[model samples]
Target chain A: AQSVAQPEDQVNVAEGNPLTVKCTYSVSGNPYLFWYVQYPNRGLQFLLKYITGDNLVKGSYGFEAEFNKSQTSFHLKKPSALVSDSALYFCAVRDGKDIFGKGTRLHILP
Target chain B: GAGVSQTPSNKVTEKGKYVELRCDPISGHTALYWYRQSLGQGPEFLIYFQGTGAADDSGLPNDRFFAVRPEGSVSTLKIQRTERGDSAVYLCASSPGVGPLYGYTFGSGTRLTVV
Candidate 1:
């Protein structure tokens, strides 16, 4: 079965420090990877996606993701963290349908 | 400027009752999708519609759940014999076509509570 995995349940980062939220996926054929962020009581906001051509995909809020074919990882990264960046991060893969990861709660400390 | 719209931002229904959740996708977006998000979990796919046809619905938990998009724009998800296990936030999203990296829009979603 196709699936996406976010091993980290929660990740904490001090303000202005680089942050990384790990994600890995398993799917047949070419993989379509995506990252999304959800705030409390709101719907998910689109972050970034990796389809083809580039391994490094940049997305909203100064966030970027590196898609690794051999490792099957598409980890989300940010050069610097902000308090507002704290939220639930979801990794999704588009197979026949979109399969999402369990989600990772990111906390940015002051 | 209008994003995907889901009606009844919150719904509370008793178990064994019937409930309907509605979604209106963005104008000219031909691919519409429905997902269910449980507490502390990511959204799970429920179904997808391309134009007026259901392209995929393999993720629906059971036969009690159904959806329709006769006009190819506004879709309604109907649940029969709702159970407490059915409680979740039903989310709706749309894109221009199948699996595009861009133009996917999501709605606030309807929080369905089954008592």
Candidate 2:
């Protein structure tokens, strides 16, 4: 079985400051990781994915994630946070079966 | 191009009533998925379709939940004898069968409220 964990229920960051949302996963074989963002009353939008190759994967809206194999983690990062970037974030793992974390509510303080 | 689209942005029905949610995947996307999202949780996969056939339906909660993609494009998720616990936002997503490399494009979803 595959599973994902997002330890933090909410993350607060100041606008213009960098932000990170932590995610970890457990899978039997090679992991396929993904990050998604959901705005209020909207469906989730794809951010980025880590299937293989590079560890650092850049995605839409200036978002990026680093896949750490040893740590079994893929944390989302933004060089500079924006108020518009505040939303619900989810970390998912696709190992034949796709499993998602409970999600992290991000609040970018203006 | 238009992303995945779902119908009836909001649906409120009484318990035990039957409801059908629809999804129109991207024009060329061959893979479609249905997921349910509760108030504060991440979307949970309900079913996945590769063309006209269901590739995986393990995530479906029970036999009362059924889905069909007869034409391999538009799909419908039907729920019978709905319960209050079934209330949630049903989301639809699609991906071009380009392997797992490509991510899914999601629909705005239909918010189902069981009264």
For DockQ, the strongest prediction is: 2
- lDDT of each residue in B1-115, candidate 2, tens digit only: 4888899999999999999999999998999999998988888989999899999899999999999999999999999999999999999999987356878889999999999
Tens-digit lDDT track of model 1 for B1-71? 38899999999999999999999999999899999999888888999999999999998899999999999
State the displacement of the C-alpha of residue A62, model 1, in Å, after optimal TM-score superposition.
0.5
Residue pairs whose backbone atoms clash in candidate 1: none
Q: Candidate 1 local accuracy as lDDT? A: 0.91
The C-alpha stretches of model 1 lying farther than 4 A from their native spots are: none
Give TM-scores for every candidate, taking all chains together and pairing residue i with residue i.
0.97, 0.97
Docking class of 2: medium
Candidate 2 interface CA RMSD, Å? 1.8
RMSD to native for every prediction?
Answer: 1.1, 1.1
Write model 1 residue lDDT over A1-110, tens digit each, in one string.
77899999999999999999999999878888889999877778889999898899999999999999999999999999999999999998887557789999999999
Docking level for model 1 = medium
